[model samples]
Target: MKTLLLSLKDVEQALSMEEVISAVEQGYISYNEGKVQQPDIVSMEMPENNGETDIKSCYNKLNESISVKIASGFYDNGKNNELPTMIGTILLFDGRNGAPLCIMDGSLITGIRTGAAGAISSKLLARKDSKVVAVFGAGGQARMQIYALCQVMNIQEIRVYSEYTEELPKYKEYVERNTKVKVIICDTPEQAMKDADIAISTTPSKKYLVDKSLVKPGTHIVAVGADMAGKNEWDPEIFKGAKIVNDSIAQCISRGETRNAIISGIIKESDIYAEIGELLLGNKPLRESDDEITIFDTTGMGIQDNVTAAQVYEIAKKKGLGKYFEFI
Candidate 1:
């Protein structure tokens, strides 16, 4: 059997933010409806190097495909090795015969799918009149989140906060160049979040970056940083009286910000409002009131990778985008 090899550029050519958002939305619905088989993430930590790696896999029965992703985060890579902080690879397989179908770069897939999740959640939970956005972090994922959000919301201005001040100008320029949204660089998280309609956190900070007092009553918060245990960005108390939604209840309860809130005794497991799928499937209510504060806690899910990678594979095949080789 022959397998296809897709490079990062090829993957990028095959995907658009809008298509990815739709695919990820359906992936979540499949997950919620018990149409996908996703196992618990296997994680490894290298404390000495301040690095961690996670292995995630999912089989989508609806698509008849399986995807396995190995993603790593070396927090000091840029400072020490002048390399990317996050790197990943994914393998796509035919579910029926267990034959390898494709091998592709996963970094872009991860970023887009994660950004799509944030956008999907914001679309369903954020107020329709939301215009001002506050973004925490100034990295690739941060850029992706803003780009995806623009597809769903009529954002007017973006307030950005990052510890690395040097990247702020580049992030601002990128946003202004791509989406023409006004960008403001803030020295503090509170300043960025002040009066913002939607706030998004995409850093890998181990310490909490947002305080409960900074959040307004009508603001929608997307917590994207805490995908692993001990990594957190929001104060546990912020979850109080807020409608909490998660991408995956099992994953979030184990590693996302929801875990932190549950561990801190600020909220219980039953307090969670619904998974993103429930909202997409119309099984639950969306933002009921403009004054209601909503939080979307996503730890990232394997099914997102499965459906996205499957779609990318089909697109690449139609475009003759990837190299083919016999492996077996």
Candidate 2:
């Protein structure tokens, strides 16, 4: 009566950022090759928060589903110290037999995989000569975003902004010693975003933190926040001007930042240029000009979780890492 058990802390020790990116890429390839299945991202409305949205996606591509729940103003309620406000789980299933594979820590896996997704997207979509990177939201996810970008680009500066105020200065210190780039904590999100070669938003906000008017033409934006229906980071006008890239359009529309823009009539379905995999696989094209803005709206792909979890499972299984017990 024994089964393998893995904890969140255990998963953290088992995987690295580079490995997560590789696994996510596998899920991406599986998706493109018609080897995966992903259910549409479905939205659930919350009663008290008009702007609150919860979205879930089950990926056939990686036999995974990522459910992200967003609740804004929870910090405003003076309960900011409890469990993390943005909370959810990623379920991983065995691809070959559909057995429940491993349930690792979602938040940690999220930080790694989502950041890797941005890194991989930038690898395929960002300009080859890009230099500066700016990130919005100075939380843990924001830190990881900067970490991932550093893996793929030789960034000159990193501008960080957060409405949270207290986190920015600490974030600046964390990046300075860890990275070779110049780290600046901006007073406003707009100040961080403008004229940057690459931009990433990791906030869970209902309103747009990135205005279309502020973006420099040809800037590559990888937006990771606003996965829920009512939550969004980039303005709809931004969608109008840029060539949009997504992980999956169907999943993107229900829970991703792109979903908000489409829901509000800011962009059309036909506007999406292609999935990031398409570009990586050579099925689509990259930026043709230095003036056309490109946005990668990421809604945590399932394959990302599946591949990463699968890797963790193999390593943990071999190491005799987790306690085992029989489930049935």
List TM-scores for all candidates, in order. Answer: 0.98, 0.87
TM-score for candidate 1, please give it: 0.98
All candidates: CA RMSD in angstroms? Answer: 0.9, 3.4
Give one digit per residue, the lDDT tens place, for model 2 in 4-45: 567767777788887787878877878778876555545565
Q: After superposition, how far is residue 322 of candidate 1 from its true place, in Å?
A: 1.6
- Lowest summed lDDT window (length 10), candidate 2: 67-76
- What's the CA error at residue 104 for candidate 1, in Å? 0.2
Instruction: Give one digit per residue, the lDDT tens place, for model 1 in 113-187.
Output: 999999999999999999999999999899999999999989999999999898899999998898889999999
Q: Pick the candidate with the highest lDDT.
A: 1
User: What local distance difference test score does each model get?
Assistant: 0.94, 0.74
- The runs of at least 3 residues in candidate 1 whose Cα sits more than 4 Å from the true structure, single-residue gaps closed, are none
Best by TM-score: 1
